[model samples]
Target: MEAHSASYLRWIVVLLLVSSCIEATSFSKVKHKNAYATMMYVGTPRDYEFYIAVRVLIKSLSALNVEADLVVIASIDVPHRWTQALEQEDGAKVVRVENLDNPYKHQNNFDRRFKLSLNKLYAWSLVDYDRVVMLDADNLFLQKTDELFQCGQFCAVFINPCVFHTGLFVLQPSMEVFKEMVHELENGKENPDGADQGFISGYFPDLLDKPMFHPAPNGTKLNGSYRLPLGYQMDASYYYLKLRWSIPCGPNSVITFPGAPWLKPWYWWSWPVLPLGLHWHEQRRQTLGYFAEMAVMLIQSAIYLGIIAMTRLVRPSLSKLCYRQSDKSINLVHNSLKLVALWCIVAAYVIPFFIIPYTVHPLLGWSLYLLGAFALCSIVINTFLLPMLPVLVLWLGIVGTLMVMAFPWYPDGVVRALAVFGYAFCYAPILWASMVKITAGLQLSLEREAFLPRLGEPWPPSSFKLY
Candidate 1:
């Protein structure tokens, strides 16, 4: 009797194990179907700021009558409070993946969480829609974005680094593709930058069939317009630099950035006085300024270093430190070094030519011309052209000292120190400002509020239903 009872228990355990496997398999496998479009947005509920942005985004979509599903893949503990908030709009389908090890919880990194959520969502391909349009929670749809559904194969609007912005893209979610993407992401075979864009760019090389370059209808008029259509993805950094390119706009406009117009001061000048919602342009402008300033400072440092080198060569005896060489050889070396340095500086700053001129005002053409000339002269003289000019000035200052020493005195230390200081001081403010703009712009409160009642509507419908 004891042996029989033990055998029965073992059989029961085996049965239970088999049942578990079937349940797991059911979750993993998905049914396939013909083309159908659905919007997908993913985020962790723990991040309150991101949650706010997500709500606003959903509200914007609802206003445009676009049907979207928001997938909040988080830990079991993440509050269901957002569901109540989202349901108020009746414009979004909120799916909370429960009792799972949410990679996004606690960790500020988006890579791991994004991968995990994407994997799970792809697994639902059988029950979910055929095509999935992935959007970031922080994205605000300004116009009707239905055109995105018309995309064939995989479709995404174009942005730079020549990679598709993962902020918004269309894909036929499949188990095979999901598995492939997760494997690639884990192995670093995809997304060297470890961002969504990098992952998509590396994984689905032939995904985006159509390329909508601009982010807004009048994006060309906006400063630094490299965004992917107004209804697609609008990053604030593009606006900060004032590059003014093309952007698509309509009902599908998407405005995305860190700080809203109310929070950012830089964009106050350009944003509409009675702004409809949060404006993301401020953040883009801040980012552009930061990068441009860094580039400028790097070029300036090269020029200053070249200047110091030339000065030391000219007055070796007067200089605190000296290179052992004949006067003629030193002069030749100085001139060559200066020229090379100057050329390098110019090349670094000028190669990536902007379509729009960077002058403060086109009417001040002569002033702009003079400024350019001055800058050019500074570069040429300091880097390559006139090595003796600085030495001549130094010589004039130390005539008495030089006469006493009976040698050419070179103030190498002073020159080098000045060069370093000049470079740092000149570029520091620009870099700081740029950083501020980018950081501020990327902050979460920039999107419009998702829940503002029309007129006399109740806070949440008294007879609302949940599925």
Candidate 2:
């Protein structure tokens, strides 16, 4: 029996080995085919806008008859809600990179985040692909881009006339090349300035190449070589037109930045009336209108409460300490009072700061009339739903206010007041606390004996601590 079992086991092992070899051979062929396949990479914090961009890309690619894969590398904390949305899209794969360590881990800084994202992209070089293209989450595809595959070399990029926009680019993935790039970036070998574009450009100085630029129709400055015509990548703003409209184009034409298009300097004149020359401007406008409506609703609620109180429609009831009834009643009353207080504060202070200026800015002959119109539209739409808008807006508003206060761009006293009251109030406390902690920690460490040196030393060890 033992001899028979041993023979059977040997045969099973042999069969398993043969299966493994067959699988390996199959995988190699697949890799070879995929080598020529075009792929686009988009990284985001996993939000609705990201999914929207993915859907648009998938549809555009399908129309172009291009065989492509959509790769999304997201952090672990990305919500599962995005998973379902991405999975539902054809030719899309969402990859969650676990235990990923960001070399640049400075949180809350935009520059640091951008550097970390580039590093993450470099890390993705290990992923199976012949060529890779990186696109921002806010972008919308206009047409089929199968031609991008033909341009593959060491690296292919879309050049903007104004700046080197890293929002989109095509490159072959090489682990060795990526590692060298990372080492150069981290060690400040090639780019001491720490700019990712400078490092990439310097590394492949000899390999930079551009394709032909497709010219646009006359009277439409939107379609010229400046519009990412061919090897050239233009700012999405170049398509900006009267009343916020933009020209439509696809896989070849993409919307780089979507969420805050109104905040862009060029769009300031057109303001809220986003040009509809593009495909998704209506959706973008709807999103903006949604947020604006939220603010207006919040203001309306406050008005409702104030009027109710003035008419004595709802009386404030007092409750004394008790075992069960008072406990429940007091809790309810406390919550109610808190809600009323918050609503009043938001209505009186927060909403007015944005709304009053927005309303009067146009009528009072302030230069940005389009901005006022946009703000008004937003407020009117959101008047009933402001209370449900995400609380992040408050946090964002505070941070924005603080930046203005710290910088003090306005010369006039009124502008200064607006800056202080609007921006400073939200950000000053947290900023002050962070500064205090850093200073105190440094002082404490400096005063410590461990940080000092023994006698007869060339210099106190603490002296080097300043570095």
Candidate 3:
């Protein structure tokens, strides 16, 4: 029985080896097909922000049910937490690579924001795929773009009149082209802008004049570089001009926010100001949700509530100490108390601005800030017996300034900056006048014993300490 079992095991091993060889031979002839690819790297201040943006893009693509694999060419330095989230949560295949050296770093005009941006060049090394659509995180897709795989060796949209936008482009993977690109970089090739945009644009200088690409219906991949219609990459700025899309060719499929980094659609406050931002947030609401920020927001809300309650409880005592009518000998003490009250009011507004998370949904962010400011200002108001309007003018000014800056009607960024400066210039005098009014009111209250009944209680000894 033992001899027979040994004979059966040997036969099984031989059959397995033969089958593996046959499968390997057959697999060598099959192409791996296509993928939608983007890159992620560290060394920038906005690393986490970009990471969140990329995950949203990947999840959005999955929601569209595009007929391609999702790929991320991430640098090895990127945290395991982010890469794991991309793989397990967002359904992305992450390929880790070393950061590509940018030879143009010594150039006078090199922008540090692109320090690790050259890592994007690794997209061409993805030779396993027959075709790849390389993208920037800021690209918002409105529809499935599976047809992009049928384009040629290189295809891009010309959002600018003379230059194609790299925010979204189709490229066929080839080791030779990738090697030549690295060679050109090492040889100090003339990259006018010293960033990935200028380097890639310089490498494909004639794409602007190429004939537009039209994907073959029979699913045949074409050859040569071609220009994609503007519809494939409608700049976000275009929609702001008309408040709607009017692209007349191809598919009005992707929106690229290439203007300002801070105004990316994923940011909660970007919406209503940029109406299209609401669409991006809607996608996020469905897919990723806001759970990541919910805990911090709740904690802040509770702290604000505690502050308001504690201030209310201590109101009569604070008022008794500070709001009493004084003789000439107590005038120095009175002036010092007034300065301290003003400082506390200023801190009330400033403290909340920093404590609130920078990327929380705009509505939540604004709401939390208002709550915190109101809570802190209550201490000052109850103690000094001051009016509400003067304390809140500064808060109102900040909100108004944000609205002015976010107005979508500005023809260009230059106009937007000028408008913000104009608003500040006009509002500075008003803010100063409000501060003077607050000071005057506080002084008058200190000289009168009957400012408010709650504050008219007998004062403690002059040496009394809050501590």
Candidate 4:
């Protein structure tokens, strides 16, 4: 009887362990509150940029005093410093999750930008919230959109008329659905675009036929899937036409940047051209101030100023050479040296543009680039006595290209590309003309001097060895 009782207890223990393992595999709904959710993961080139954007987003939501919890579905690899800032500084709740394996990553045409985007499917496992509005970090909130909680089990906007945008959507968390979705992923579900957008769209292919959602007057939660109005997820492109928003429906709440990745509102250069980008910057200023990048900018500015000063103070002279007037070998060497000097000037302008921080405010970034370029170009000018017109023309050309690309009236990206191409075509001849004039001036200066010191001129006391 003792042995039989011991055996029974062992079997019971085994059953308990199996039950716990099963429970751990699927989420169980517990909390009753609603939440505003967004996901963050690493491995993207724009990780820091997105990190800043997410913080600004959460802070803006808090500033609006929304009635729902701000939740970030952060991957486990996201730095503790970032997650801590979101939790403590920004008053956001972070749910750490593993990077969701993207089964479609091996397929051709898959965008690497969306490599970790499938991590968004973890929203369904967030059973602590009765409803969650999954958001993209690029969303700029114009007003509180707490009413999104009233949306049903699945709801999204049809920004493209037929297809609903996944940038922002409402969903009710369900463990069974989450489990089934994982099962589908494991079974190699058809994800045409190889991202969450395609997978979710495929999962709910019938949402386009659903009725428009109208929340009941008494705040009763919606049950079935429905379509959200365009006002909730207004595309940022719409405001470019008139530079004003006129979306008629629910409160014009959130504006999403569904255009080019570089034109996202968080990018400082995206403003003044996109106008709406300023709104995002304003939100950032009100919440996550620019103090962090300011120090780096100040340091860079001082370094550039020092370089300019040193280059001006020490007028480093080149070695004086003797040459016959009709020597073809000397003439070839002279032409080669002139070409090298011109290339150096071009490099001076370009190298600094890439060296400056990528996401600094546009004004600061452009200012630093210009100053650094000028400093570098001054070195070439002072050393080789080359004319500055060629360098100035190149700088002006860069500014022109930016303006043409940022012009808001282009009907589509293809037209924008063509406009840029046309601008380049028009500018090339002028640039060539400047280069020719610069080379001519340089040649004239060299021939007139004939590499000979002026009468009674003393040799420099210090010289760099160039062996």
Candidate 5:
């Protein structure tokens, strides 16, 4: 019995090793047949936003060592210089289609918003491959997803209950289907969501109701249905959902940004408005890290509350706390600009950190984010915030910058300005506290004129402090 058992175990081990080799070979063949594609529509000029995103996708693909052909479809407005760079530098087959004239409306905000949905159909023009995966430019793949190519030509994630997010999908390129879709659009077919997603779902209306089965690259049949393992096409905003527990596990292949246009990862200014950016650091961390980013956000929130407290609660208490009140009329516009500069200063610093993850090709995004941040900051600061300290900081910065400029080896004045503005921006907490106190005093002077009762005064702040 022992001899037979030993022989059986040996046979099982041999079969497992043979199966592994067979699967590896099958994956290689799938790579040769499958391709990854993205679409770019530029009606006015070059779209550096999409280019930046596409570059990251290519870099990530290289990092993951994915074995699929990368393809890009662009509109005529996009310059060949950029396309050639994409092809030569990033190894992409960029096909420029004539600027398509698409006129379709869904009678909603999203559908009536953008005029470029029809450009995505160009993916079907590439019939050279047996299968293709369409990934949005705003997506980042965290792990190898060569397995997705194994799914059927119509595999996608069931994003919400019955709806599928079209940000990521697998489909076989067919010119015939593309033509039919164009015909339908020309014939006034309506898409409720108003984008390629809505239009494509119109083609597979019953996709949400049914589960599909197809062959994997390993020559084994598997379920190709709308799969939602939370491991693929994870919406970045989904991390912000207030749930008890959402620790990352298993294989999270793609991180999708299905957020508003302003919330795109490239738009760093939006981070200050929505704390959703906190989850970004959390997602990239191991061991859960105890929500360290959220702690920072909480501090940010507390600072915001402290401002409100000074403006609302503390101002009223000054009367009861033996504070002398005198009339001091102030310019409303000046104070308003002070508020603007106060907020803009935060955005200026916060924006730079957002682009740190994309070290490559970060120059454009960083400079743009900083310029925009500073332009807005300057407008607000020069307008208000009383550049008293900032101007001094700036002068010292100018001295330092001039020294750097004296050295022929240093970068341009613009780079030096970031360093100056960076130090100048650091005076937020002091400025914010002083601004709130000053503004609150002015507010109280105005409140007496309105004949409104004083808001109940909370205890003095110093009394509450534990020494």
Candidate 6:
């Protein structure tokens, strides 16, 4: 009786283990058919802000416990590893798609973009999905939005009183609709935005009609719907306009950054520290920390401010410490050094063209080369082509990027070490001189004052003018 009892216990344990295995498999493998989908497209990882936002959107969805099917339609430009992360980490089904043909390919920044606005049209081609919620990567979800799946074939939010925002929309996927939309695009019916939103809005112009109308699925009823609530797609830019004291429109589910792409949340410097800043902070993406990034900015700003500060604070001390030298020689030597430094910095940027010209598209390669050359020439030779501050920011950003990339294409030597240092000092003395001139209330007419133009701007006209 004891032996029989022990045998039965062992058999029971085996049955329990097998049952648990089956249960685990059932839980992990959710079927795609008849499930609602939230779809995004990623063509490149180069757009750091958009990429981070996309990750946050997926993570937020998981946090909300919304089991909607996650899908990413991607182009070949997006790396396979990203597709793997979407599948394994975010539970997404990544469908590879070819970039749509663009008649404006050469003239316009359409599908050939870090913008990738054209890729959104691919959502219409997802015939397998029961319903699709298309979201631009620049959006963040605040709460669970699974109920949107219950929405009709088309549903969107209207941020403006009249114009509906296309960043977020709910639609049923259909190849028939996709082909027709493509046909419309082919015939040049794109909206003013010149993105996929343009083509979509043109195709379905009656979005604002009361009891909104949308395409029926295979002779299904012409289902009409209500507008998506204002809170569903909150444009944070409206904080200064309409939402002053509180979010006047009630609780928000999704926040959309509909402004210039550069002003996105990841760029902490552009956003202020109040209602807008805190919302972005709450998202708390596991990135190189904002404060850490701020520290970098602070260091950069200090370097900038130091020059300005010195110009104001050190005039009394400057004459005390050193003998008066020939001002023209000082200006000429310092300016020449700055020009050399600027050249090294631009050359550092142009290094990629030298190293990986074959990998990049020919047009891109030549464009980068030409652009870098123009920047270098602008500072040293052609001063008035582009304004100074914008060029300075571009130069600094490029230098910072090269520092992070560790000057990869550069040859390792003492020469490389000197080149790096040379790039850092590009604006050092010039910025100081410019500030000194500004503090002293000097006129900086570039055409009239040859010294300031050659030596770099805003400096007081030298009494001992080189000319």
The top-ranked prediction according to TM-score is 4
Candidate 1: tens digits of C-alpha lDDT, residues 1-467: 89658645654453344334335424633232322222233354325434444554555555565543433333333456655555454334444333322223333455453443432333223234544566665564556665454444356655554666666666654545554554443334533544455555666575344444433443222221122454466655443333222343633356555444233212222222212222332222322122323455456445546655554454212111223244446546444444454465445334322211231122122223333333443443432323433323322322322233222232433443344456556656655554354333322111111122223333333212122
* lDDT value for model 2: 0.40
Off by over 4 Å in 6: 1-46, 106-115, 212-222, 241-251, 273-275, 286-467
Q: Which ten residues in a row have the lowest lDDT in candidate 3?
A: 458-467
Write model 6 residue lDDT over 1-467, tens digit each, in one string: 89658645654453344334334423545465333333345545444445455655666666677756676666546667766776787776666655554444544444455245666777776666667788876677778776666667778888887777788888887766776766565555645656766666666778788553333345343344446777778887655343332454535678887876445665443333123544554664432123423453345345435544443332221111122235556555444444544465456346534432221222233344445443343333222222344335545544453453244344333444566567658746665554354323212222233433333334443323121
Which parts of model 5 have CA positions greater than 4 angstroms off?
1-31, 44-46, 105-113, 212-228, 242-250, 270-433, 436-467
Could you give candidate 5's per-residue lDDT for residues 363-429 as a string of tens digits?
A: 2333344434444344333333234345234333434433443333324344544544664566456
- Candidate that scores best on lDDT: 4
List per-prediction Cα lDDT, in the order shown. Answer: 0.40, 0.40, 0.79, 0.80, 0.54, 0.53
* Candidate 3 off by > 4 Å: 1-32, 316-347, 383-385, 396-433, 445-467
TM-score of each: 0.39, 0.44, 0.79, 0.82, 0.56, 0.54
Cα lDDT tens digits, model 4, 1-467, are 89658645654453344334324422433233888989999998899999999999999998998888788888779999998998889888777776766879998989999988988888887676789999999999988877889889999999998789999999998867876776677667999899999999999999999999887888888889999999989998887655567798777888999999988888766755576777888888888988889888888899889988887677553436534345456677577778787788879988887777666777677788888888898788766766777757877887888788668787655666688799999999999998887788677656654343344566544543232
Over 149-241, each residue of candidate 3 has an lDDT whose tens digit, in order, gives 999999999888888888889999876787678767756799877888888999899998888998888988889999998888999888866
Which prediction has more favorable TM-score, 1 or 5?
5
> Where does candidate 2 stray beyond 4 Å?
1-65, 89-91, 98-115, 119-127, 154-163, 189-199, 206-232, 241-252, 258-273, 276-278, 281-467
Instruction: Please give the lDDT score at residue 225 for candidate 3.
Output: 93
TM-score of 4: 0.82
- Pairs in clash, predicted candidate 6: none
Judged by lDDT against the true structure, how good is candidate 5?
A: 0.54
